[model samples]
Target chain A: MDRSNAMPTVLHAPISPADIAPFKIGDVVYISGVLYTARDKAHDRMLADPHLPFSLQDACIYHSGPLIVKEGDTYRVVSAGPTTSARMNAQTPSIVKQGVTAIIGKGGMSQEVARSFAGRCMYLAFTGGCGMLAREKIVEVLDVYYAELGATEAVWKLKVLNFGPLLVAIDSRGDSIYETVRARSHERLLRLIAERKRAL
Target chain B: MPSHREAFILHVAQALQEAETRLPRDVTRALANAAKVESNDRAKEQICTILENVKLAGAAGLPMCQDTGVPIFFVEIGREANIDFGLKEALATAVQRATDAVPLRKHAVYPLTRRSCDEPLFDMICDVSEGNRLSVAVLVKGAGSENVSALAMLEPLQDVRPFVLNTIWESGGKPCPPIIVGLGIGSTFDGCARLAKRTLLRSLEEDQSPFEAEILEQINELGIGPMGLGGDTTALRVFVEEAPCHTAMLPVAVAVQCWADRKARFSIKL
Candidate 1:
């Protein structure tokens, strides 16, 4: 494990799937390296064919289909905000086990995925709709892996800066912010309804 | 005819861009009032900050919100109007330009591959009504609140209160607090969904139907509050739009618009 840059509050990792397994809840992580973008269709394809197009070992997967503009030889990311993570719930565990280090997306993931990948990979929630801000951190768009997927769904290798202001929602210990919030909200809602009924 | 087409397209585009640039007047006022009425200090402060940010963004010509949203256009075209240009194409072109010009965030996703690293702006839906005068309403829906939207078809005899309340409860803090609930009732499943989307475009300050007004009061009484932190103002407003439906089914669709509630409308004659 690389401890040279790890701080008590946040850890700096060359971030790979292997490195993600040991992270605990509330651990702030600054991922500064390459990550790939994929959303619905890409997930479907990867699922249909057990053989992934590229090696995902120790890599972070971002649930985003960024706006890009092509230059002479490279592509520039205009906005690369994270999409809702819940949409990818079914495919998460499978992708996580494929050696994904961390998952970056908005909203929350499904309970099954959270439980299955608990202690194996961490899920980080990014602020939704901050595409331009997210793009600012990208140093370069390394390469486009799947052109057929079009710009939004293609897997593009992105090199990032202090790339994230991510919240540690799901830790290696199986803790999930989504689950906690949902349970609490449900209880509060029932109480509110009950009170209203009593008053009626 | 061409002139009318040009006028319609240009006016609609300009209206949408201007709305995108400026904060909705009612929203600005409501947030201020909400801040004053809110008892929770933290939620009050949050509302104040959000209002301030909106003002600053508008003044500086920055996006009102980070999520400019997928540009959804609801157009009512007059049957007698002789428009030479293709309305859909014109709107699409305007959107593409706005995506770059207003520098609106591109929120459109390609259905397959989900690889939208480029060409971010895409049309989500467009509804056209034939008429003599064209009325276009543009609503820019952000992903945060949209992610929490829900729809359910109830038995004709079943009460809808439970379904609506449960959906709102499930939404929690994800949609951002103090949301506007757009309820579409009485249509087919898909029609109701579209009605729900269209309802968000209605002005918050306008007087609603009597039944809807009563429902709105009840919904706000839910106490979901700002950011779901718990307070008196769970929902800012509720708009219900209905269409005639079969007696056997009751389709209900709920679309939640966050505090941002970005929308604008314009009309043109050809």
Candidate 2:
């Protein structure tokens, strides 16, 4: 893996099916544009609501519960990093159906989520716990929805500029680096356990 | 003028702020070393970004991670110490102050209702020490790692290796590797968890026991890598804390901690 050969592919959001089709697992990406924050609570609430305050058409959803604070009339993002996407696995297929083209999160989503990305969606993984780095990329807090769910759980609409260095862990073609890694690890785990037992 | 208790509370708040904003030297050094050893490009990128985030967070005096995490305090009180004020109340007050001052995100909520709570959320563990000083160490634990921490009571004959490996396997990237695996072996169920959690407070620079070193080697062999994306480094270190347990029980607790490994400590004589 020559680090120099793999420069990050930067995609501006409102990303379309065409925009994401070429990305494959192991490719690096950087996103710049509108990103909405939605954690577990916000996902459930959004799906349950018939009339959403915003549209998901060609949107990029960030699986994050940022540490944001309000100073007078404006909201400040102190830190904003991706939360585990697997936790949102149950809701993601439906979210993709709603037209979310790119899901920016950390960790990996389920194989079902990979299936959901068959033609239109992709999962970009920002390094988990790099909130400060993420915050630095977020240029503005455009607006917020579901404020009633409290600071951490609410939906925050944000404008970001080159908010990445994210890895394409799952892609539109129904392939996933996570699944590959998981299968390999499980096999190793079984072998290790078997060897330990044999030594006994 | 502020009283001694007030001063102590202020000290705790500062420590919390310090822990939240900066990556401790041991943790930072470990991550840097891991980054150098990573063979996978994606894994290397993640580790580099994490190092950059740590630097930015410290420079700006902002939290290194958004989930400023639940503050768990390990308080060591000397036997000869005398406390005129309520230590628990002071600690709670310090948490609230730190929450506001460090601007810690409010993470407390009523469990069943899922409604946010006004009071600060924290946990404290106290133990007696030899001196007349009160030493408090705060471990800032994020939900990603904390959620995956597991406790199992295996039969006395059962092997501990499989349980630890399985826990890490199931956790995958959810706990955010390269992580720290703190193993507590041979204690009561609850005590095992405490023992495991406490191991995280130790400096990563400390020498690992032979058993700890063996488990760590096995874990990295799984190649879950950084963020489980298939790399050479899945976990940076594994710390084991063992205790005597019931004859029939072989309790094991795996306390997973993310790379952030945020923590700070302060000691005061009263």
Candidate 3:
């Protein structure tokens, strides 16, 4: 697969669970068209309310709260950084089951989310703190889903180009870079300590 | 006092903006240095690319990375200053300006509502004392590092060594290694949290206390290295902050890792 020619892949909102199951680890997806941007609160509301503002099938939720600067009739994104995705550990599995095909955010997802969404959805870990660079990918902000949620938490419909240099940290196969690194580090530390103790 | 207040706020704000614009300078530098020394080519290359990207962003006036984190102010007020100026309000205003001018990413979220501010400015956690001289430290911590922050409460009689090692090991490359470890001992949970933040204020070359300096040396020996890619430079720096605590409880909060430990400071006289 030639990565450079991988034009953005667009998926509509309200994606189904089955739709999310097929995406592999390295595939670069550009979720343009439509999707809701919800963080902790929005997630809670969706969990509580039977009817949400929009459906979740075939959907991709981005863990971001962008800073939007308004000009004339339109708003421009000044800084749209990816928030810490680990904070959404509790909510991701449910959201994934609810038809979230992919998640774009900084950092890695939890073990539970990866296990729950095994071979179903992939987590794209975009570089955190590169809001300006990330903004370049967004061609235009189509609509703001929840104005009341404020800029950081508002759901934004965006049109994106190559939008990402995102990495496949957590894949549909239930593999996670975070878990692997952590476990290996722990093992290495333990071995070093034991060796030191024996030498002493 | 008035002159001092004005000077302090303006200087602090300027320092913060400069810090943001530079974006992870020390971290980028440290990562590049680590890459040179690292044995793993893949990890070294990754670190190199990350450093290059950060440099490019700085040159282009783009954010070093995306998560322009919550602006945390670690302030130390001296015992003899008399000023009527509202520091908090001034800070808010400065932050608002910085958000627009430097164009920092908004990061604050309304706790109860879970609603985030489209243009967040002030998420001030102030520390006050009785003096005329004030020292302020600003650390714009990105979410990547913040995600790896951990706290451990140990028994008064138990040693803190194991807990520290475990936390860092667990953190792994998650915090973007070759990280800075901020250890806070003896304070209450909240106090420990503040201590951890305060620890980041120290220069990468400075150590707050002797014990802390020793612990830092030990931690770097872990070999977590830059980007957790592995090397001798596991930690670029380690700062420890301690306070008095209860007899029965020895609260040790280890802010395990911060990838881009971006910090700047200013002093004011009133």
Fraction of true contacts retained by every candidate, in order, equals 0.09, 0.91, 0.27
Q: Encode model 3's per-residue lDDT on A57-92: one tens digit a residue.
A: 667677777767678999886656566677788988
lDDT (Cα, 0-100) at B68 in candidate 2: 88
Which candidate would rank higher by DockQ, 2 or 3? 2
Candidate 3 lDDT over B1-270, as tens digits, reads 134556666776787776666744556666667778777644564455456556656676655555567778776777776555777867777777777777775667656765555555545566678768777778887666766677767778776777778777766556766678888888687788778777776666553477776666666666565544445666777788789998887888777545556677777776
What are the candidates' individual DockQ scores?
0.14, 0.90, 0.27
What lDDT, from 0 to 1, does candidate 3 have? 0.67
What tens digits encode model 2's per-residue C-alpha lDDT throughout A1-200? 55467666779889999998887787877889899999999999999999999999999999999999999999889999999889999999999999999999988999988998879999988999999999989999999999999989999999999889888889899899999999999999999999999999
Candidate order, lDDT descending: 2, 1, 3
C-alpha-based local distance difference test score of model 1: 0.71
Q: Report lDDT (Cα) of residue A48, candidate 3.
A: 73
Candidate 3, residue B75: lDDT = 67
Encode model 1's per-residue lDDT on B61-80: one tens digit a residue: 65655556766777776777
* Candidate 2 second chain TM: 0.98
Residue A36 lDDT in candidate 1: 85
